[model samples]
Target: MARSYSSYIVAQSKRTPCLQNVCQFISDDCRKHDCKIVSLEFFAQDEKPRRTDLDQLNLEALLNTDVCGCQGRLIIVEDLSTAVIETLGSCLDIDPLFFASQIHGPTFDIVSSKPSDAILPSRALSQNFLSVQYQRTVDFGACSSAPRKMLRNSNVPRKIVLLPPIKNRSIGLEQQSCSILLSTTKSKPWLGLILVDKPNSDKYTTSEKQLVLPSTPFQGGYEDFSERPCFFEPDSGSPGRVSLLEDLVYYWEKERPPAFQPDQPTLLSLTYYPLKIAAAEWVSYVAVISHSIKQFEYSTEATFEEHGLRKIDSDLRSLEVWGRRCLQTSSKLQSAISFLKYQINGAPELEEYSLMIRDFEYIADLVTTYGRRLEIMVPVVTSVLQITDTRRSLKEAANVTRLTYLALLFVPLSFVASLFSMNGGVSAHDLTIYFAVALPLCAMVFFVTRLPTFDFVPLGPAFGKFGNWMRKAL
Candidate 1:
């Protein structure tokens, strides 16, 4: 049976006509094959954290429920479908364009349609509910080292499956889009909704073999080379592909900060922790990319000759790709900072997050620095390649010069010897004449070739006068 997303439309006559149109569009756009919900977690300062099964609970009522004192509730939706998006949009009264951006991945011109009174971050739409959408860089270890045809199979499970526009490309860096929407009121703190675009990881199994293997057969590893030069193994500490929902759940369960007290009146402190975590994760990505760039640069410098020009050229292109991705990530972080600044300045309810503003600024600055470093390193790498080419050219020219000298010395002697060996009257009568002619002729050739080695100080003025005379005559 074919699954039809468009058939499951929920009617909401209470919304504006514009919203209705947006909802209809979302319903139509929902893919028949959609991502399932990963997990549902609710966090409270005093009570133990708990997970709710999707089949047993009512998402609509749960999202709309008023919790004046609870810390926060986080809903993790993976590989978005029309039903989940439609339901969340209706429940939170979120802008339709946000879901639109989710359906159609964020673009360069992702700007809010609203005026400055409600300007949101990149691809975000400001309203009574505040949301920010940003791209998170994924570290695919050696799978992204060099361009190859590995991991192309769709049937194989992957830890992170990017949206249609972002999948299966050698863009130096791979990214997944994540949007965080916070619904708040004057009395209530906020209800957090995080929409992710990765596949659910229920069936994912990580092993020693899996660590060495890429997701698809043609994804990114040499099947033959054990120590593949192209493969870049991510650091064990690096957070390569993390689920924001799962990470939050883990933090709330095991690593919940002692600072979060039950006496706190608002959930503002708990809600934006995910954003902070997101920013911190980017900091890790910048480090990993920078480390990879440095490692490649070192290899090129160490053995430029052994690798040859083609290898160095490929490395240069890879460096440029890394630099570009870093710039993009930095730009996204800057937008997040701007959005937070606006929230802190304008929204009285968000004044508490002023400190988080500094943290984001610091992280953005760090990423920008690494990006600039990669940019600077590109020219240095080019220079090394140029030096290698120059060396090779000089060596080849020297070999040609040696061959020319050998030909000049042997040609005159061979000609004289052949003439003496002839039987006819035209042949040389004696070998002495042959020797006499060949020796002087060889010396003359040598002198002519070595003329540039002599410094003609005595004739310098004469040559200068002659060159001036020719110029005047012309």
Candidate 2:
């Protein structure tokens, strides 16, 4: 369900009607040129997941959605659409056909050896979107088809670009909104959005367009795609909310030390949104992994030896996934950092960009290194567990062997006593005979058991000499 966030921030009018009513209310003064912000949170697994989980990517469906302002009024479409897609080779290991099928569903029919997994007019869009394979040697082409029935689940598609036409009789005609982004965390490395409407020459075009209207969160049911499970989630609409306006509102009200310029908001929304998203990603990951490390180490300790091995197994796997995430994330952040290069505007913003890039770049590396080291401990911990099992087994076997030897010592005495008792009646003389018989057997058994040397090497030289002498005597 979409709710208006216009109240959260300072806006001219707070009339947040359903998104369906956009056409009837488009002409409203507050609706026109009013900044609309929509934030969609993304969630993805570390590996290629089953179709049921992701269904169709969120962005792809959004781009393909029939967005109309009125009942059937001509919605403006962007003249040009630009998208930057990033992916890791490890994530997209399937062939282009299979990948496309997974993303576009069974209806997704883009059969090619090269990775063009996107549903776009040009093959280059798919090719560019297949940047994951680009990281490694070119390989992931097509794989066997996995058929899925016509599924219209509640799953939200990847990137949703709503480019409705701006109708103004005063201006030339109607101008369209363009620049579409269709990607997922697995298919794309970095997770952020850039939505800006520039003044396109012609009629109905204006520079006051903000991408997402309705003040609503334009996200579907991504119950799974959540931030890394952290110690605690920052308050919503808080500075930690990862939105430019939220922070600006807090800054304007709370921290009003220096004269804050108006452009800072634009700089943040346009350029630094990605950085904020990326930074949040890093923070969430770091918090989760650090907690896991402690939990893992604690579980594997001697005190918790019952399921120690299993605990290590889980924690180590987590570490490995985290490392892969870091490796993939670093590249995506680099692209973002590079993109931030173009976003530099004034002196103050430039300095902010430099500091952010420097600090985040270090954090990106720090995450990678920390995760790799943690992952390496998997094998070591595994070996320790094996040794612990082997040692326990050996000790048990030794105890069993000692018990067997002790039992052997009493077997002969038990047998002799049973034989004597088998006689129905025994006189004193018979008892004396039984005792005598049993006594010699017990003495012989004891003597053998106590022998210092069971085997004595005969005089080998005497045997050889005797054989020679015997031959002559015979």
Report the C-alpha lDDT of model 2 over 21-110, residue by residue, as the tens digit. Answer: 112122232322223233322223211111111111343443234332211111111111211011111222212222222122112223
Clashes of each: 8, 17
The regions of model 2 sitting more than 4 angstroms off are 1-154, 157-237, 240-269, 298-306, 341-349, 418-474
TM-score of 1: 0.63
Q: How much lDDT does candidate 1 score?
A: 0.51
lDDT of 1 by residue, 1-474 (tens): 742323223332233222333344454563544444533344454465556645213666666675655555556666666566657755665555445444432222233222221333443424333334443333333334333311211121122322111133322223345555555533243455566555222222233212232332112211110123334765223222345555555555544432344333233344465566666556556555655665455444434365677767877877787677667677667766766675555665454466677777887787778778778888888887888888888888999999988877897798787876684554344666777899998886665555443344677866555545543442
Whose lDDT is greatest here? 1
Highest TM-score among the candidates is held by which one?
A: 1
**Which regions of candidate 1 fall more than 4 Å away from where they truly are?**
1-34, 38-46, 55-73, 90-93, 103-125, 128-172, 183-192, 199-242, 253-271, 296-306, 346-352, 425-440, 453-455, 458-474
Please report how far candidate 2 places residue 260 from its true position, in Å: 12
Q: After superposition, how far is residue 458 of candidate 2 from its true place, in Å?
A: 17
